[model samples]
Target: MPQPESQNQPIAGRYELLEEIDHGGMGSVWRGYDAVLDRPVAVKLIRQQSVTSPELAEEFVKRFKREARITARIQHPGVPQVYDAVLDESYEQLFLVMELVDGISLRSYVQPTQLLPVSWAAAVTAQVATVLSHAHAVPVIHRDLKPGNILISHDGTVKVLDFGIAAILRSDVTKLTATGTPLGTHQYMAPEQVRGGRTSPQTDLYALGCILHELLSGRLLFTADSEYMVMYQHVNAAPTPLRQLRPDVPTALEDLVLHLLRKAPEARPADVQEVYERLEPFLPSPGAQVSAPGQAGPAGVPDPTSIFRKPYAPRARAGQQSAAGQAAESATAQPAPPVPDAVRAAIKVAYSRSDALLEDDRFAQAAEVIGEVIEPAALALGSESRQVLELRMNRAAIWLLGGDYRAALPELDALSDAYARTSGPSSERARACRAQAARCRAELGQVTDALAALRDVLDVVRSVDGDVSEEAVELRRDIGMLFLAQGRTTEAHNILEPLHADLCLVLGPDDEMTSEIAEVLAVIRLDLDGPPS
Candidate 1:
């Protein structure tokens, strides 16, 4: 359900930001839904304060666009796919729409009392290296790579997040520096980054080393009282070897960590390939039973090596039908038994509550009220049954009224076809559904498709109830307005001229609807005649 703060308004007319997922000094990330695609997305809203001046704002926009394009080119499964980059008209808000990765951050797994298994740490690190290898090939350096930016997805695949975010944030950091707003995690920052030097793939390797060290030792590689002290330690301090903190760590793995942590960029391993090679020794072989090496490190941790153990394993079979799936499948799957009396009564009550919610302008909650009864009603009455279909139509109306056009569009389309199949295409219900679907398309800026859909419904209405019917008049007005919006003034005039005449004949020129059409036609005529000579 959408929150009140969002009020169903979409970002850039596409993504509807739902809930704040994470926040930092730079900006906040939101769990959002992409209305046009009907899918979930993660939206990162960059802080505007970073762009202090006109020149910096211009530079930031250019850099943000460039970074977004490069980030999209990485093309690795470990990297969350970038869907789009949006800068609002005023350039005050910047957003990056990305795949909503469902996973646990590596930060959550790095508790002081809970050391990760040696093989697990190597598996996670190796995966990160593989991702870095691809990104580095694209010549992208992840300026900030830390445990918090790494995630293990549900299927045991590592996801390196915020691929180009740090670079975008750094664009305006020089201006923000005076405000004492730091740009990166100091503990995981590379020495070069700390010293304000140029960064390359080697810089990311240093951060990866910090992550591996923390994963193995169950603590940050460096600790200090302040960010300055942390940066100072990063530049001057020698990282303690992993084996010293975790005796079970293999010598070669510790050596690789040390290799990654080398202060000089050129002093680090040649590339991520070399780092992965050293890690290969600790990684489990294909189909190998993976377990913590030497000692149990942590309980209930998701095994990162499962990708190797069962590469591309098939989806697990569900033992029982899920209620969500059941509800969806019941639509057009097969007819079930008739609705029980108790459920029928409950559906009636639900309808009343949903109507009240809709009157209050709580569209999401209105839809939710109907949704609560859909599953049970669908299970008993069957999907295409009159009662169930009515419930779906009402729920879809709520979505449409809420300005969730993407959510409503598909459901309306489906319901239209269902009505046509069950009650005949020219039936009032079917025609109404088609008109509603057109309205959704129009709202979503699909003007061409919306016009065609509206025309088709209007033709059907004319055949059923004559051209002067209320529905016919409304559809004609909608089609004319769409043409006018597209600047097809002649076509709009032609459509509305006849429509306005009919409204006056049927409802009288003084009627509200008739007068509104008269007003629209008056404006169209003025535009046609070039503004009263």
Candidate 2:
């Protein structure tokens, strides 16, 4: 451990030391003030050792310089900006100056009793993916990515810390760490990494997997009485699936986690881009409500998902009085021109085009076409008219299909309300709309509310249609998935086991739905049995 420097002393005659922010085996980090630049900075001072020989000191200097160079090469917002690396005349002390990040380390957020929301965990992982993507492009492997090295900023931006052990994948530089010893946190090391084998971008993915699993389950991926045991588990033991511990975790997400934890580096997702794509469905869309709205953990604690939930959404430009006046003027001015017959026909053509585009997987173009008709259709026909409502509903469905849940969720809620009024609350369309909204909620990590809404819908469907009806059966399956997500495996098994039997009788075992239910049953059984030895 390095002793703290005198508070009044300034390193390199520029960075004025203030107070210690953190200390680890490597060095001490201080909250510093740049006297010349008149700005705050984080100063990391490498611990000085009384080496008996010059060779050890020279080796330390090379490692220190390598860390600074590798970290600087990673040009990303998720990484703290490296300002300077200072070596004194006698080489007794080393210092690294960097941007002062006002945030808490992710280690503080890990709790045994309280797990983070699924979206929050996914969002953090996604940001880390973005960071890793940038770092890997520079051919730098983090080698160590534990919770302690991840910081959630005050604005909810995730900043990956500590590239002190990062390895620059260049043909020229020799291997840094000793050949026999692995370099990473025991709980998060990939099998290849634990075996002291070559590491690549996939090693970082493996570490991220452990972090995400911990975030969702509120516990480490593998915990043991000794570090050696934990390392052994990383190499030889299979991870307990997140869904087994926290049922509210989506099956898709659990599968992603498992893929990331694959023992072989090649078995993981091909790149960070693939990991980010996998995480997209679980990330909250712009303006989407978070699972725990308004309550972002303890006061002053940042919500990691805020970036995804409200990414640069501009506030209303008009002032309060100007907005009110504009609204009143619009209410009186909107009935001026009538939509022509040609325009109505064009709108119909647009809807047809959108449907075709949707089939081609051109979601953005499909959405654009549907959006183009919405205003014209609403203006010609009343906003509440069947044609306009149908157009809006179709647009919402497109948004949902595109995975733009922020836009889809509000539209679904409004459509549900509109259908309840126009077509009676008991109407199949209204029930279907509400059920779709519940699914959106579930995807957004509002599991409890989604489960409740699903139950209510299921009750209504069962009351009107029979238990064996297709709609009721589908609802039961959705409910079972929610139960599985919430970690209620017994309940999920109980519900899905019977539902699978019914599907076989009604839809036959060959049906897609039956096959899907069968897969879920297999997963549940595996969870019950524990991982294969």
Best by lDDT: 2
Quote model 1's TM-score: 0.60
Question: Each prediction's TM-score against the native?
Answer: 0.60, 0.57
Number of clashes found in candidate 1: 0
> Over the stretch 228-324, how does candidate 2's per-residue lDDT look in tens digits?
8998999888999888898878999999999999988899999989999999998877877654563344333567777877786443221222232
Deviation (Å) of 519 in candidate 1: 53
lDDT of 1 by residue, 1-533 (tens): 12323326778787878788887656778988775665678988877786888877887787778778889999999999999999876667788899999776888778878777788888899999999999888777787788878888756789998876534234554542333433467988988887776677888899999999998898999998898998998899998988888888888888888989999999999999999998988888887764434534344445687887788886443223323234435544444645589779989999998888567576766787798788778778777989989999999988987888877877888899999999999999999999998998899789999999999999889888999877988899999999999989899989999888887788888999888878888888788646667
lDDT of each: 0.81, 0.81
The candidate that wins on TM-score is: 1
Model 2: colliding residue pairs = 247-485, 247-486, 247-487, 248-485, 248-486
Model 2 misses residue 121 by how many Å?
0.6
Model 2 — which ten-residue stretch has the worst lDDT?
Answer: 316-325
Error of 2 at 524 (Å): 82
Model 1 misplaced stretches (Cα beyond 4 Å):
1-8, 166-183, 291-301, 319-533
Q: What lDDT does model 1 reach?
A: 0.81
